[model samples]
Target chain A: MPEIMVFAATGRTTEQKRGLARDLTDAMVKNFGVPAESVTVQIIESPRDSKAKGGILFCDR
Target chain B: MPEIMVFAATGRTTEQKRGLARDLTDAMVKNFGVPAESVTVQIIESPRDSKAKGGILFCDR
Candidate 1:
């Protein structure tokens, strides 16, 4: 099974997330020739405070 | 460099996430003997409705 995990800021609509999941699965299936069901996608949402970039926290931006 | 991503339901404190990141990085450093700074940890949160298992959505359960 091919597992893909994405991390983004919180607050996306369900439709958007599902669309992304399907799209991601499609990519893997078409490229790697894996079955759709064999692909697993997990979109993880992180708060601004939890993520930092270049020594600065996202929440501070 | 190694990247470890985790997906879970939302509502964890920043402290918890940071602790997890540190711990995960530590594990990679000890096991793989990679530099601590080379490990990337991203904690992603998903809504229950966004995840499905065996054709049954998490929100429906």
Candidate 2:
């Protein structure tokens, strides 16, 4: 089972999420030689306050 | 760099999210011998309708 997890900041539209899932599933299927139905793509989003980069919270950036 | 992504249904409180991030970071640091600062934990939550299992949407389950 090939599972793809994407971590990103919140704010994407439903359509964007759907497109990403589809694209990622297609990539896995083509590169990994796996069935599309067997691939799972999960998008994980965090609010700015909950995520940090370079020792600074994203909300503070 | 070791990044941890968690995908789950939405509903956790801020405190729970904070605890999970801390615990997961600690786990990576301990197990992988990586510095705590080197660990990144991101939680992605989806509504029940956005997630599915066994060919059925979670909202319907």
Candidate 3:
């Protein structure tokens, strides 16, 4: 069983993430053939300043 | 337009990821009130030995 962990760290709210996970789970079950319980989507919320690579934030621009 | 980029870097095939994206997009549209074209899922595949923390790979076990 492959646990699908979605690390959503940007551009969305927690409620949105939950909704997304629900939808994704349903889709995976119905179409992608992944089991309902196997899908685990996690949303790690990042502040507006959190995204950075070498001190440059893509979302800030 | 919001893009749903799914960075799947472990334990899945490319075709499986694509299928997931398609299914996720459809489910988002049908149940979660998101536009179909606004969803963009990207799968970044990683080698089994690529997962590391302080130079130790977890998938090697």
Q: Enumerate the candidates' DockQ scores in order.
A: 0.19, 0.17, 0.23
Worst 10 residues of 3 chain B by lDDT: B1-10
> Candidate 3 DockQ category?
acceptable
Candidate order by decreasing TM-score: 2, 1, 3
TM-score of each: 0.55, 0.57, 0.51
Interface RMSD of each: 3.5, 3.6, 4.8
Candidate 2, B1-61: lDDT as tens digits: 6877677887877667666777777777789888877766666778899888998988999
Each model's chain A TM-score? 0.88, 0.93, 0.57
Worst 10 residues of 2 chain A by lDDT: A52-61
**lDDT string, candidate 2, A1-61, tens digits:** 8989788878899999989999999999989999999999887678865654333345555
For candidate 2, give the lDDT of residue B47.
88
DockQ, ranked from best to worst = 3, 1, 2
lDDT pick, better of 1 and 2: 2
lDDT of 1 by residue, B1-61 (tens): 7899787766789999989998899999999999998999987676775664322335654
Clashes of 2: 1
- DockQ of predicted model 1: 0.19
